[model samples]
Target: MPWIRSHITALLATLLVATYAAATEPPLSLRAVTAENNEPFNIVFNGKLQGLGVDVANEAARRSGFSLQTEALPWARALETARQKPDVLLFTVARTPEREDWFHWIGPIAKREVWLWRLRTRKDVMATSLDQAKQYRVGTSHNDAATEYLLAQGFEQGLNLDITMHDRAIGYKLLASRVDLVPMNPLSIGAFARESGIPLEDLEPQMLLISSGGYYLALNRLSKAETVAKLNAALVEMKADGSLQRLLEKWQPKGSKARSPSSPP
Candidate 1:
């Protein structure tokens, strides 16, 4: 009787473990996506997604005990699809107030600043304030949250704003005087300029557009709340263990690099 009682207890423990594992194990694979050609954040390297954002997401998913299947999509498409779909993973996203309530947010995975860059050679072009800078032709990336933030601040296109395919291309447009000004961040701007044969010293941050914001791993509004919680927990652990810091450093650029992005809290 005693042996049977002990055996029943053992069986109960095994069943409990199985149930917990089932509850916590992530789905076979989750569809993950990041903006196409948005380097240092999301980009295909050697035919695979391998950027700071992708690396961080992969680690977070691993810590959470799941696997992430990543895809590269254009900025606009990535945003729209993630907005409409569920359980889809979108990362390295800047958390904005206009979009605060839309997604199930998970992190301050990274930090970046969106600033207005102007040609240093253009002495005739100087603005002490954003309003003064608004008078010139400004180039921005399509669907970039920084652009949206500017829109919220009354930056108008055609009249003054020029939407471009790539935010980094704005640097080229500026060098050619195609646009008087452009909006970009430090993380990839230097590389963008180098690739375009434009000197980094030629451009300078003229205005602090978005002081600072956290880039997050955002889930669609329709995602399971439990799933969100699981991802968040894994991320919290990452931050606690210093893996997050290491990931940031791994993506940190070397020579001919732009400004370094600060760590998010």
Candidate 2:
């Protein structure tokens, strides 16, 4: 009877240990969403999602002991879904004052400069200052932070602001002279021109909007604090180890050298 009692106590101790481990373990699966049509950052190629943001996030999730699944959506819809759903992840989002409190901020995986763009041939259109830029119609996408900055500077819809849901359409409108200016990254010049069926030399940066703005991965506000902490730690380790920099170099655009992962091109 004494030996039987000892065996029962040992079995109960084993069960408690297993239960405690399960309760304390972090979740091993995650869902993330990104904006479509953003090449080299969050684009789909050959039916698979692969880009700088995708690659960086996948590596970070692996280091954090999690598996990540990603979906590509329209920019505004992706922003909305990540905000509304608990634990959802969004990546490569510009860190702006307007968006600072929307989610738990993660690493600034990439940095890019935004500028007002125009046709290279349009020498007559001058945007020497923000006020001068306001005199001309500017193309913008829905819920874009750069657009928000312009609005804060007094650009009004249907007046100087030409708004659209498809980001590529803004480039097309700029090509056709429907809008005098549009916000763009110089790095995207070749890709956008190709997508718009124009020559790469057609577009040029008119005026700088955001100089080296940081873009980060964000998790929903409802995510567990531990989840945020794990991801944050993983990104920090990756940066420190130079693995993040090497990964960015692997995806660097053709004909251009890669810059530091934390620095803008």
Candidate 3:
């Protein structure tokens, strides 16, 4: 009877180990970066950081029982830090083949559409097709994925500018008839124009450049796989429960309507 009991105890212990491996694991810690003064996507308010990407990251942390620490850094620097530090993460990154191997990606958090926009007064810039728009100079951000794509396609990159400088420069050039077109995201361009006192009506979409790929929460390669896996599971849970949709609507820019499941580009 004693031997039988011993055998049963050992079997139970093995099963427990297997169950533990399959269930939700314990908490972990993560570091994330955002712009020093960026808003709507990630921002600091009342001494606390909060925004769409922040909310998503916090939710993921809570569901996974992890602690999140966010810091404000320049866009290019933030991405570089994430790439260099094993503990760091970057959000809302547009995934590309070149970046696919850079980190462990965990999402398609948000989506946007890139566009070629021109001043309404610019008659020569009007185009029925992307090929036609290629004939004109398009203002773009240096080191941006859109810029890379445009360059690869033989579209002449005009007035290389940083992300922070692109808006004002683009608007001035458009109004002064310097550059033929400026490539930007619709929602972002609209928001910037309104904030800077530029009339939105003056801008017209020439051609849809490409479907902006969804945003992602990426982990550095040196980060623990178990930690990343837990966060990933949390994301899947959020997506299934419609929490992600509600978050998107809450943070989306004014006058921009939410896309339905049935809508086409």
Scored against the true structure, residue 188 in model 2 reaches a CA lDDT of 57
> Which parts of model 3 are misplaced by more than 4 Å?
1-28, 37-39, 44-48, 158-166, 257-265
Poorest 10 consecutive residues of model 2 by lDDT?
255-264
Summarize candidate 1's per-residue lDDT along 136-204 as a digit string, tens digits: 888888888877887888889887788888756776778788888776667777766666677877777
**Candidate 2, residues 90-194: lDDT per residue as tens digits?**
987888888877899888887767878788899989996899998899998889887888899899999999989866797788878999988866555556667
TM-score of candidate 1 on Cα atoms, chains taken together: 0.86
Report the lDDT tens digits of candidate 3 across residue range 140-219: 65456677677667665333322324456656656666667777665466555655455877777777786856678888
Model 2 clash number? 0
Model 2 CA lDDT for position 16: 99
Superposed model 2: Cα runs more than 4 Å off: 1-27, 256-265
True-structure RMSD, every candidate: 3.8, 4.1, 5.2
Estimate the overall C-alpha local distance difference test score of candidate 3.
0.71
Weakest 10 consecutive residues of candidate 1 by summed lDDT: 256-265
Q: After superposition, how far is residue 65 of candidate 2 from its true place, in Å?
A: 1.1
TM-score of each prediction: 0.86, 0.85, 0.78
The models' CA-based lDDT, in order, is 0.80, 0.82, 0.71
Who wins the lDDT comparison?
Answer: 2
Compare the candidates by TM-score and give the number of the best one.
1
What's the ranking of the predictions by lDDT, best on top? 2, 1, 3
Q: What's the best-to-worst order under TM-score? A: 1, 2, 3
